[model samples]
Target: MSWKTVLNEIKSSDGVLEVVDARCPNEFRSKRLEELFNEWEKPFWIIINKVDIVPKAFADRSKKFLKENSDAVDVVHVSSKKFYGFWILRRSLKSYFRDNKAKLVVVGFPNVGKSSLINMLAQCTVVSTAPVPGHTKGKQWIRISSKLLLSDTPGVIPKEFASRDWAKILFPDDVEESAFILLEKIKNAEGSNFEELYGFSPEPSEETLERIALKFRFLKKGGEPDTNRAATKLLNDWNNCKLTAWWL
Candidate 1:
């Protein structure tokens, strides 16, 4: 279902569950959702999930950035995979709805751990989950606690432009440039060796597609680097969280 429709129907929603992938906080920012939340006067708590793979420094910065820039009542870093930080989240939720059960609608970009949050909060596997994006196709009501009801909706990703938009996505022709841009971000954030993560070193203006092609043995006629294939593989690796220490 479209987010517009959901937001319209839930104008009376007690709150919004704004889930975001902590590893790719910049990429997951949703201007549209923020606008809707503000328009509808719906209070939100930004849940920065998937904290296990990230350094605490990164997680702390992400939470601070989100809290400072947004009108969120609260922001908490969580890792459903490692069973971390849910106790604080649970306490916050319970405190928020001390007198009445609040009906909250969970929304976020694809694969941000919405279902996993529901499962963790309920302390059972009440919603289906997958490692892939768009795994939860529709909406379901999940009881997180006696005083909290969550409406888990499909993960709605912003429409990916075929061009570079952070790690959001890349246009086919812009794939190599996108890789360089993302690598630059990693350099600034983690300062990890790009070669260690991607299996090849990148030279200034040296094509990432070529490096990936040679490293992965992706070749075309005359043993030429299969650039298109290589570019797609590189992006897929990024999409699947394979090519970076700080991958989302």
Candidate 2:
């Protein structure tokens, strides 16, 4: 699916469009989501979640870029980590709902923090939230109030979103890459560090994997962690995020 496809999906709906882009900064940037904003003739709001994980400098820059991208857009920073910006998002719901008090559809790439946002606003754990992708398979409609109806859909990867370069830059390509990044940064760490890094714990210890790769002679002659192969496996896993279990 192309970015245009997402736009078309929203346009096709009868309700007012409140395009919820739940993807992280990296995924958002890799797809050049801002370009979509520039291409859109209509105005939209951006509720960028996981802000606590993203640096303030980056967030500030993204806000500026988003604002400049569209006249009708407002970018808000949120981190479902602490349930920040939920009220701001609820208040921002006005621009789309208007006097019609119509249904508002929330759409974005899978695992982009949509369910968590909904749970916060509804004050009920009606929807599931996980770090892995492709968790939601069908349409799930949630009513926030008499005036507001929120609908959730399965994560759909746009056909035009085929840039591997973009993908790697945004999300960690796989568990290995995530593990390696976390491990390399560890002054002194454990499974919890890796768990927090990728949002999941591996069945085999990451260190065990590293040792196994070495035992199998997968390492380069240069004595590196064979991160290249490790990153490749991880990217594949991440790209096909449906294989992973949802965070329950």
Highest lDDT, which number? 1
- Over the stretch 16-121, how does candidate 1's per-residue lDDT look in tens digits? 8778777767557676777877888787788888777667888888788888988888888887777777778767777777878687776766566776776676
> Judged by TM-score, which candidate is best?
1
Model 2, span 99-150: residue lDDT tens: 5554454545545566566666555333432222342454455655555555
Q: Model 2, residue 99: what's the lDDT?
A: 55
- Kindly give the stretch of ten consecutive residues in candidate 2 with the minimal lDDT sum: 239-248
- Model 2 whole-model lDDT (C-alpha atoms): 0.49
Q: What ranges in model 2 sit over 4 Å off?
A: 1-9, 14-43, 124-139, 167-248
Task: Please list the C-alpha lDDT of all candidates, in the order they appear.
Answer: 0.66, 0.49
List the candidates' TM-scores in order.
Answer: 0.76, 0.53
In terms of lDDT, the poorest run of 10 residues in model 1 is: 127-136
